[model samples]
Target: MEILQIDDTLSLKRTVDGGTEEQRKAVKAIISEVRAAGDQALRAFTEKFDAVKLDDFRVTEEEILEAYHAVSSAVVEIITEAAANIRTYHEKQLRPSWMTTAENGTMLGQKVTPLDSVGVYVPGGTAAYPSSVLMNVIPAITAGVERIVMVSPPGQDGKLPPGVLVAADIAGVKEIYKVGGAQAIAALAYGTETIKPVDKITGPGNIFVALAKREVFGDVAIDMIAGPSEIGILADDTARANEIAADLLSQAEHDPRACAVLVTTSRTLAENVLDEVYKQLPHLPRKDIATEAIENFGAIYVADDLEEAVGAINQLAPEHLEIVTENPVGLLGKIKHAGAIFLGRYSSEPVGDYFAGPNHVLPTNGTARFSSPLSVEDFQKKSSIILYSEQAMNENGAKIAEFARLEGLEAHARAVEARLK
Candidate 1:
């Protein structure tokens, strides 16, 4: 990993944004064909990409029932604990429909209703992640989504990983499917003969899966255009180099494109953390992927001051940000754009990733500057609430009529005028 010395600002927005365009175009093309072709396209793509010849895509209720006993008690206990934490966190994020009545007789309120159905795409085959099942399903359940459907590519043996099935069931998913990749996204976007279309889709997958989600976003509501996981640490001389290095390796192991970065004011600290990262990498099972990710995108920045370190961190806008400084709470206010903020040495990134109540599915790349982590709010929609009495309408109708005429939307103004009259 190259150490970028921050004496001046360099625009990183162009670099990150420019990288996804090609993948986006290819994904958009796949979605269009799949939406138009429907069932046949899904079948063809399943064979083409997943190398599986599946005549049926829906997982049976029988399979879900059997999934319970397929896993050992130890795994079930872990999933149970994670689900409870996730459900607890998301329940707090729930906001019911609200109203404030005026002195006038007009009744008004916003109805907060969950989507009737939603799709959760769990990556299967070799890319299975049980944690993602918990992250995606718990919030949708909390938001009151009536039917939650899951899709994942099946193995040659025609079964999902027992852990993935166990996690989804624990998180309250009502259905599962044997489809994956862009076609699975397309199947969720446009219903096939077997798989029903969903109102929204949430989960993480490969670049193809990500691109497909982007293509079908408007047709079917999507959580975010997810990229590889990323983490940025803002530390000082007071921070522990070994712990900081471990945190960096954590994200790097997620994917080959994942990024782990450190920005610090102390030059010696930067060097020490880099050494620790090398030592830690050898102990991880996913060392090859983490090594590729860290060697390519991982970096350490030595800043002249804390302000400069923060300025660069903001430019990155990482999915996970940890302040491992002496007074992490003091530095809390300084961070403006991170999917989630972890403070103190013990409050590492993995706390939020697993047992902590917060959602692990978060905005990636620099999207944290504008987007947010997934929550119950993502599963629900809000409609604007407006109320006006006859008196209020009568007083304001003429002005609204005049303004509507300026925009050539007189019919809109006339509706109010007619109400007033």
Candidate 2:
């Protein structure tokens, strides 16, 4: 990793929007074909991308039972515990409909309703994501969404990963599909002969999958256009260099473009972390991927003071921020932007990713400046409720009619004046 002085400004947006023209064209064509041909297009694209032909895209009851038995009992137990934690955290986010009445007999309130159905996309093959299933589906379950659909590609051997199947079952997701990529996104947006359309889709995938979600957005809701994973650490001399290096590498191994950054006031600590990163890089199983990521996107910034370090973090608006300093709790109030925050050295980034009950699906590419993390709010809708009694209307109708007439609309004034008499 390269070290830089904080005097120089950094450009945080890494890649071009929607990828290259070729990728955009390819994704556009896939979405169109899937929209036109439906099931036939799904099967053709599944065979083309996944290299396996399938007679049926839906997972059967027997296959799910086999998946449960195939996975070790220990794995099942761990997933169950994680699911319970997620459920407990989301249940606190549940909202109820409320109304308030005034002396004027006017009632106003909001009605919170859950979506009818939702689709979750999970990357298949070597990217086994049982934790993602738990994070995406549990919030919808807590929001009271009726149907939860999951889609993933089968392995070359033509079987979904047993752990993924078992996790889906644990999360209460009943409908699992054997298709993936942009085509799968299209099927979920516009219902095919076999698969019913969903109200929303949530989860992460490759560039094609992200672009497909973008294209089908107005037709159905999506979580976010998630970019590569990133982590930003703000540490002082009191922080451990080895622990910082280990946490940074956790996100770098996810992709060659993933970013890992550290900003500190101590130059000596920066040097130590740089040395520790190089020492530990070779030991990782995904060392090649992490190496490319670190070489391209990783950095260490040495700031003159802790205030300057906090300013830099605010400018970057990282997806995940870790504060490891002498007074982490004091610094927490200064942080203005970040999808998630982990304070102190004991609270590592992975604690929230896997076990801490917070949703790991977060805003990326500086989107934390405005957007938010995946939650039960994403799976529900709110409708405004309003009621006006005759006495209330009589009091406000003439004023409304005068305002409408001032706007040069006779019909608008008449609508309010009709009830006046």
Candidate 3:
């Protein structure tokens, strides 16, 4: 890993966001073709990109039952436990419709409604992570969304992974489609003969999938456009070098462009962690990907003090932050921006990624400064409620009409005046 002194302008912006002009154009074309051609477009694109020709797109009930049998009972138990933890955590975030009425008889409230339908994209390309299926679908289920549709690319064998299908069943996802890429996103947004349009879409994907989400966002709500995975460790001499190295490698192994950084007050510690990273790299199965991420996007910066490290972290706004210092909780107050923060040595990033109950679908590319992690709220919508008694309207309508007239809205003013009389 490269080492640098913490400067005012740290190079956290070294990586680019997903999709280029050419890629964007291609994604738009796929979306357009899918919108126009419907199921036929999905079939053609599935064969072209996934290298599998399918007579149908929906995963059968028999396939789901077979998927359960395919995986070990041990795996099912693990997923079940994780799902319970996830459900418990998100249940705390549930909100109810609320209203307030004043003595003057003005009633104001918000009605929180779950979306009617949703589409969740699960990537089955180079890797298949059942954790994502759980993270994306559970919140919608908890929100009481009526219909949940899931789409994933089929392998060359024209089959979905058993773990993925099993996890979907655990999450209560009923409609599973064997289509993927930009075309799948289009099918979800605009509706094909086989796939119905959804109110929203959520999940992580590659550049093509990310671009497709961007293009269809206005037509249908979507989760944030995720970038490459990243982890930032803010530590001191109290933290273990080897443990820090292991945590960094977890994210680095995700993609060639993934970033892993260490910010510390001890130069000795920085050097030790750097050496430890090299030591641990060779042992990982995804060593080649980790090495590329470490060589290109990874770095270790020595800060003058913890304050400087905290400031740099806020600037970077990392998707995952691990605070391993003498007092992780104390440092928490200073962190202004981050998608999810893992405290202490034991609370590693993967804990939150899999079993920790919090949503792992996080905003990336420094968007955490303004955005938040996926939560039960993402699956629900809120509408403001207003009702006034005749007495209340008699007192307020003239004022409302005057305000509307100041904005040069004559129709709005007249409507309020009519109500007043």
Compute each candidate's TM-score over C-alphas: 0.92, 0.97, 0.98
Global lDDT of model 2 = 0.92
**Per-candidate RMSD, Å:** 2.4, 1.3, 1.1
lDDT tens readout by residue for model 3, 1-421: 7789988778564566666889999998999898899999999999999899999999999999999999999999999999989999999999999999999989999999999999999998779889999999999999999999999999998999999999999989989999888998999999999898999999988889989998899999998889999899999999999999999999999999998999999999999999999999999999999999999889999999999999999989999999999999998999998999999989999999999899999978888999999999999999999988899989889999999999999999999789776
Task: Give the Å error, residue 387, model 2.
Answer: 0.4
Candidate 3 structure, TM-score to reference: 0.98
TM-score, cand. 2 vs. native: 0.97
Question: Scored by CA lDDT, what does every candidate get?
Answer: 0.85, 0.92, 0.92
Lowest summed-lDDT stretch of 10 residues in model 2? 8-17
Q: Which candidate, 1 or 3, has the higher TM-score?
A: 3
What tens-digit string does per-residue lDDT give for candidate 1 at 244-360? 999999999987888898999999999999899999998999999999988988889998988888888888888999998878888778889899999989999999998888988
Model 3 poorest ten-residue lDDT run: 11-20
Candidate 3 residues lying further than 4 Å off, grouped into runs, are none
lDDT of 2 by residue, 66-157 (tens): 99999889999999999999899989989899999989989999999999999999997547999999999999999999999999988886
- Residue 306 C-alpha lDDT in model 2: 95
